[model samples]
Target: MSPSQTLEDESHPSITAVNRRIQRLSLHLTPLPPFQPSPQLHMLECAKAANKLEVDKASLQCYMRGKNRELQEKVINFFESRPDLQTPVGIPMEEHRELCMRQIVALVRDAKIRPFRYVVDDPAKYFAITEAVGSIDVSLGIKVGVQFSLWGGSVLNLGTKKHRDKYFDGIDNVDYPGCFAMTELHHGSNVQGLQTTATFDPITDEFIIDTPNDGAIKWWIGNAAVHGKFATVFAKLILPTHDSKKVSDMGVHAFIVPIRHLKTHQTLPGIEIQDCGHKIGLNGVDNGALRFRSVRIPRDNLLNRFGDVSRDGKYTSSLPTINKRFAAMLGELVGGRVGLAYSSVGFLKISVTIAVRYSLLRQQFGPPQQPEVSILDYQSQQHKLMPMLASTYAFHFAAQYLVEKYSEMKKTHDEQLVADVHALSAGLKSYITSYTAKSLSTCREACGGHGYAAVNRFGSLRNDHDIFQTFEGDNTVLLQQVAADLLKQYKDKFQGGTLSVTWNYLRESMNTYLSQPNPITARWESTDHLRDPKFQLDAFRYRTSRLLQSVAARLRKHSKTLGSFGAWNRCLNHLLTLAESHIESVILARFIEAVQNCPDASSQAALKLVCDLYALDRIWNDIGTYRNVDYVAPNKAKAIHKLTEYLCFQVRNIAGELIDAFDIPESITRAPIAMQSEAYSQYTHHVGFQ
Candidate 1:
């Protein structure tokens, strides 16, 4: 061998050594798993399976529509048949407002739907029409709500017979378009703090409505900008004392103040109306601000069911305290919150239907050489949509229950039931609207780039639904009211006060869940246990009861140093959680009851499945809360997560029937992506590509 070859051989490692090193490295490197082929999911087959799912769509529809299925269909049919009522895209705000007003006019004159007539004679029918209108066009819904629910409701609920007799016909017919001028520039949730004053003028026998400062100007008043001829204006009622000449403030009262001339449609002499201009959404509302220099209405215009001004200008109210009278007046208007909650569910149904329908058609990556899988088949997409679908079902039942309770309260006038309804409405409204708003954004994202298109309806739906969280009642403030009411009930429970029907669970919950959860039950991970209605309800009750006890204790501990309001401020987040927990429990209970009460076995079974998904998904999302308190073992939490996914899969299999049960007409959805067939083709046509 040459010396150079010998050197090279020595410099390099021997072949045996290299082999040994390679063997050692191979030991550390993990081999990729053997490829298992993905099962091909055919879009047509999946769609067929969804349609074949044994769910009683008609029964489910009837259950969801509650009191007025035929009436709702009648109203929806009227709007669907009219091309003029169809929502147009990309219109200027002014044109949209005009369209909305025209749609309302059509409903009254063409359709012969008298909204105010139903206020007393048939409130359920009235609400049914409201829901139907809202499902078609949210802007038109708000206009109708402003004219009928708020303005006309004020007269019906707060006014005496004479006021109703004079205004109901014109208001209902849109001859006297009216605004509900309660919200001010600086004050909204605090209705008691409204700064507009209505001072009684004994000589003129009229009440002078004045906006004292810019802050007192009525803001966000629907119909005020162009159409409102009058307003149900809320202002502090000041009356001269009989003994002294000084005036006394008698809290807030509603007055029917004329805002515009009936003949010329001009602003009244003392009223200044300015368009609120553009908004993030609901531009069809024609929201405007109003300022009164000295707008005057006769004393008889006062909605005097609870408080009144006499001919001599003396203020009298059956309730002695000003606060009590104000409470009573506001209580009469809880229907707005109920209507919002009920209508928000409709928006959620529409959004979920759009997203789910599109998901069923849109295909993406799958097994090679096979047809691409429907996006709805993917686990991630199911996660985004199924829980929301389940929640829509849950809220439907809860909102229906709310309507029933409100209707009963109106008939019976039970004071306890009234308070119960108030608190319940606040909680449901806050929870449902907030959930719908958030879910709309999720729906938008779930549809990928197609969802981003304005023509898809997600953008407008979300934008308009977003304000549902603010108007009626600010969600945060409404939740605080719920917390306050819960605390009151918590104290009353200790004093041996009988709990109302809605809250009777509190007594049992305190007894059963105040202690640590049973080890066997906490660690139970079986599918049957996790899906059990009893087990699910027990878990919800435990969470709410524990939260109530803990929050009360925390507040007591902090109040010594922080004072009452300060203590509450410190525990604000905890209080919100507590309120939400309670509301969720209420919703779950209502859903369970609905399933049991369902007449059709197939529909009941379907509803049961949806209910299970809602309950388990809720618990899974808050598993940390359960884990922190040892209410659920780690293994059980895993089980819940697994069952939740499984339920999502099951629901996905039947998504078609579930959404179809909503029976929303395609014309109302107005999204090319939501088309029953050839969705992509319709989408292309919508975008002007064809």
Candidate 2:
């Protein structure tokens, strides 16, 4: 049945069940997570809870199972309400995140407080923020806010109110920091290629912005095609066809253009608009194109913060390099990567929360008479869920680092830092969203076929997150950029410092691995390390760091002899693999930190288990750093199996709170598979909503 139909079928029953639940909470339905001790711990804690509460083991087990069912049902109900908002993939994940985020924010505006209950009841806020429905990715817009407020918004605008400025008044519609026009169809990733000419018509003392060809039209601009009424358009400054040569009129420039005639949504005369066509994802944004044909604007409309044209039509700029001017314009895109990186975190949240919760409630194996075993009990399930959990934690750590870098760069206003952050962000952005897309799919699969049901949420998240891998820049392409940056830094190491020492050490390690007796890119096995936390951590740390250095070295060495394009291609070939390994290595490092920092005994044990899983799981990826080595072949199968078992064990311990992070309230997730138990009283019921 459609989700709408499904919800209708269960709505009445759910209301009754909810009412019973409220009454039971007044009595003994189920205790809260933090207070219940074994509330989220499935087996061991539950066994203890039975002893402490003097309750029957069977009854407590039944209660625990039923409450989990209720929570899962809450999640299902959340999806049923937002039917039009199917999670799309490709570039769509970014928009979906944005769309869900905004709606969630809108819900908070009037709430007495930003209640957790609201996110479950109306999740559009979370979902909206994913960047669907619109072509413009709010990720950049968000950074714009971040830079502006440092309070909330990144360099992107935090839509405070409508602005009816001289050139554009309609920009006031959307909330927050905003974006300007820089990307033209011809310009693409190369902004210096822009051909639009914005010339000062001396008599009128107004700038005439014109697109000379279809190729010169601005395309793929997030806010430009819609929502954004005011755009800082880039055009070449040209002296009249009079006394000066092209050089005399030379230099690309930026101007503020009022593209739309606000009230009517009509393009100003000489401005033509068209949708960039249907896209793979990020549909909520009207990713459209804009063209100008002698569009007239007042002389002051030129964005002259860096350069200016006088009323008499004379041109002047404080900076000398036209190349630098071009760089400045493209430089604005720096925040794009930062916002995208943050966005990946939110997408990971929605995905893991759904997968973990569903994993707990949908138990399939057990005796015919006994309660079914939670799917999480199986080893394979842990292999799927735990690594992803570790991944979410890993990226969160990296994202925090990126955010801090962004903060420092914001304060320092260092141009080189901006570019560096930009490159790193681009690389990190690609790594994260792509990995999230991969991991979310894995999460979907780990839950068995039930993961495909729309009501289950995985299929939705998987599809929705599909676009994240390719949107901002194609994942492989972005990674190639990262690889290039790595090579550049490698070359710059002659200046030597502590980091130089590390890099040199890394170079030697890669050389050692490549010099292995047999290095044929064999798969890795972690059998011996499966039970040994230190071994697993050390092995992963050593191998991953080695692989990254090797990949970076190959690109750098090739550049000196080959032409630039060939050099880039040489690096590009290894980039995707390098990015994957880099992300995994980074994740492992953070996982180790979590293990070391865990204050509680159980928590430390739990983190150690996660570390083992993370390390052992990617064994082969680690060993690939070693050249084709036949020596490690005999133990491969054994290691894979042991790692698999470890994964299962870890899942058994932490499946409950994993589900809680989905933030789905007990009041919601009511589909059939998500049902609670039948053990409850007339005063208190158990069973998923269905």
Candidate 3:
């Protein structure tokens, strides 16, 4: 039964027909022309599709798209104009990198369309522009992310006014392309362990930067292989050798280091650069590694807003503790985490769009008296896909809230607000990216074999997005960061210490439940109770509170015997669960708030159902946890299951419309089976099936 032996003889009739049909399909298949949907067209489609949503279609689309509908179209149109921007199959990796670099330059060169220039002037527009571009091509999205969000952002957030005045204009106009050099080969998530050193030399009034070993080399740097002329390098700032004595480490600080000659595009002396070579996806990005041997930059090159070195080489910082200062410095890059989360959700939308479209057009077995039915009509398939469709909507609103929070945080230097933003960003990035990876895999399976083909785009998307799970921050590690913050809040509340207003509701619930004589269990008489946003939020809060308390008890028990680190390690699993609950609470609250605040009744009603489905689905999945904590009765879990089934069916009818609200460009989807305009007869005729 080996493939070679089997192929030596003529294939069976069914196999022959399948092969012929595939050949015919291949003949008709071609690269899709570039496309970007106009905002008007997007609005019009929503209008036509509103009946399915039980809302004002145009209004819903506008609300769903935020205020960036027009900007999104412009982004699409920009990509459509440059075919080379598309990451075509079979192209040489080197050529792909070059084309991406060229397009990035062109996009940023034009004064009217230049995206980086707005990073400081107008952050909202900058975010919208980056999201739009990212939605089109992740490779392009990441290039922009590295240049503006990372390298340029480091200057905006970490550097002082002096650095801004010197580099802001050049950064916007692509005068000298740069990379964010932070992750070293051995110390990515554990950033504190990075081995690169920048030691101040008083005699020369310069900092001598060196990658002490191979492990300290900056690896996986976007724009590093070739194009970047400079980098914002993060290293342990070693105090200057002074007073005939050794100086201590000053902790991690960012420095503007020139790695390449501006004119020649050649690595400067004492710098070695090498490409990371091929990767699973996102090949167009020129990811590379860098090693420095006594590279020298002037003292002023340090990005010294938070921490500075005096002319006499004394290290000083405004923050009280080195850890606090480092945290503050790293917090400045929270936008990267936020952007990646947004991008993950965007990728999810496209994945679901292609899967839903394919399921609609693809036909399968039916009764003898009837024609074949679309796979979408089958309950099993709907069960797999519709919930993901609903989740896309849920995360969409949550991401919007996160983006707004980020914007507000940028305008002020409020400490508590910064911490809240950090926890939320870290939590959501882990939640959304992990969900996206699973959803994308499911979408690929939903498409059956066709999804495996490169032309369908899922393979590229899945591979490209897979890295996101670990890139900005490892999802598991990020969740720990979230959990650690939540635990602090919980402990503080119990000690009668001040708690942030952000934790007010959760804290109040904890106090109320702890004082109650009996545990609060689900008491809804009917599944109808599941649809109430207040009920759903309350139930979520109850479960989250119980879990938080459980985690607290477990940690306290472990701490008495095992010591701090050991206790944390032993309870890591429960801690992650606790973090997930807190995050889910935030998502539910955001979703409910969004639905309740809608101005249009119809839009509100439609979104209400969408929100219900998202919340109910989550509860249904975690019924075991709910029961474990005595937060829900067995009967209630059963009721949740029934309600979940009903909501899936309810969501199924409007699934297409829900995805359409995402307004993903057809050009971006690029799946042959997703073409609704093509007649089945053409396919049948080509296959000689008629």
lDDT of 1 at 559: 100
The per-model lDDT (C-alpha) reads 0.89, 0.53, 0.81
lDDT by residue for model 2 over 78-131, one digit each (tens)? Answer: 444555433333335346445644533332342212322211232222222222
- Per-candidate TM-scores read 0.92, 0.67, 0.89
Per-residue lDDT of 552-664 in model 1, one digit per residue for the tens?
99999999999999999999999999999999999999999999999988888889889999999999999988988778876788889977987888888889989998888
Model 2 earns a TM-score of 0.67
- Pairs that collide in candidate 3 are none
Clashing residue pairs, backbone N/CA/C < 3 A, model 1: none
Better of 2 and 3 by lDDT: 3
Which is the leading candidate under lDDT? 1
Q: Estimate candidate 1's alpha-carbon lDDT, on a 0 to 1 scale.
A: 0.89
Q: How many clashes in each structure?
A: 0, 92, 0
